[model samples]
Each structure stands twice: as C-alpha cells, then as structure tokens.
Target: MTKNVMVLVDEQHRLDSVTAAVEACGVRVQRVMRGMRTIVGAVSDDAAIERVQQMDGVASVREEKSFAVPPNHRDIPQ
Candidate 1:
C-alpha cells in the first residue's frame, strides 16, 4: 500500500543528495522543506519506505496522518 511520509535528513547531508535518494526509491516528493531538513512524499510501498529510511543521509521516517474535513469547514473554500 502507498503511504505519505515525512523524511528527516541529517543536518550534515546535502538536500540534493537526499532528494536524489528519495527519487531513486521510486517515491514522489511532494514538498521539500529545506530549512526544516524535512521532505514530504508518498512511497510506493513498505519496501520503498524501508529503502528511503536506509539511505545515507536519512535520519528518520514517519508516516503523515491526514484528516478529512467538510468543504464548508475548510479555512479556504474550494
């Protein structure tokens, strides 16, 4: 199953290297927070998640939890 995850990188790691590693795992990078050293994306499966976690500069990987809200309740109308 596919899952959204937040990838945290080591401070010493270069963002380009980390991004390349994530892409190599076949995961799609949604957003890159350079200052925060965090990458958010969706992995193809559990194996992909493991692969990303084991990459050279990866510090940790955590699943991203999302919640559904009615359109009317949203901060910005759709």
Candidate 2:
C-alpha cells in the first residue's frame, strides 16, 4: 500500500539529491512547503522515508497522515 510521508530538509543542496533518490524509487512529490525550512510531501512506501533520510542534507523524514487543511489559505480557481 502507498503511504504519505513528510521529508524535512534544512540544507538547500540536499534538495535535489533527495528528490532524485525518491523519484528513482517511483515516489511522487505531492507538495513542497517552504517556511523557515523546507517540508516535502511525497507518496511512497516506508522505504522511501529511509531513503530520503539517508540523503546528504536531509534533516529528517517521517510518515505523515492526511489532516485538515490549514484554514489560512483558500482556493482561487482560475
């Protein structure tokens, strides 16, 4: 079964490497949240989490579940 995961990366250089690794495993990046840091939303199996964390600059990675969307933003259909 496919699972959702959140990968947190603090280093900019690691972004590409991490993305490549996940993509190689057939994982898809669903969304990317950038704040004081970067949070990546991906869909894959548990192995993807391990692969992401092993990347050169990944700060952390964890399995995440779907929660209520933050209310601060709304859809602006064009």
List per-prediction Cα lDDT, in the order shown. 0.86, 0.65
16-75, model 2: which lDDT tens digit per residue? 666666567556777666553455566646776777677766777777766564556467
TM of each candidate vs. truth = 0.78, 0.59
- Candidate 1's C-alpha runs over 4 A off are 66-78
Q: Which ten residues in a row have the lowest lDDT in candidate 1?
A: 69-78
Per-residue error (Å), model 1, residue 71 = 16
Candidate 1 has what TM-score?
0.78
lDDT of 2 at 72: 62
CA error at residue 38 for candidate 1, angstroms: 0.5
Error of 2 at 57 (Å): 1.5
Candidate maximizing lDDT: 1
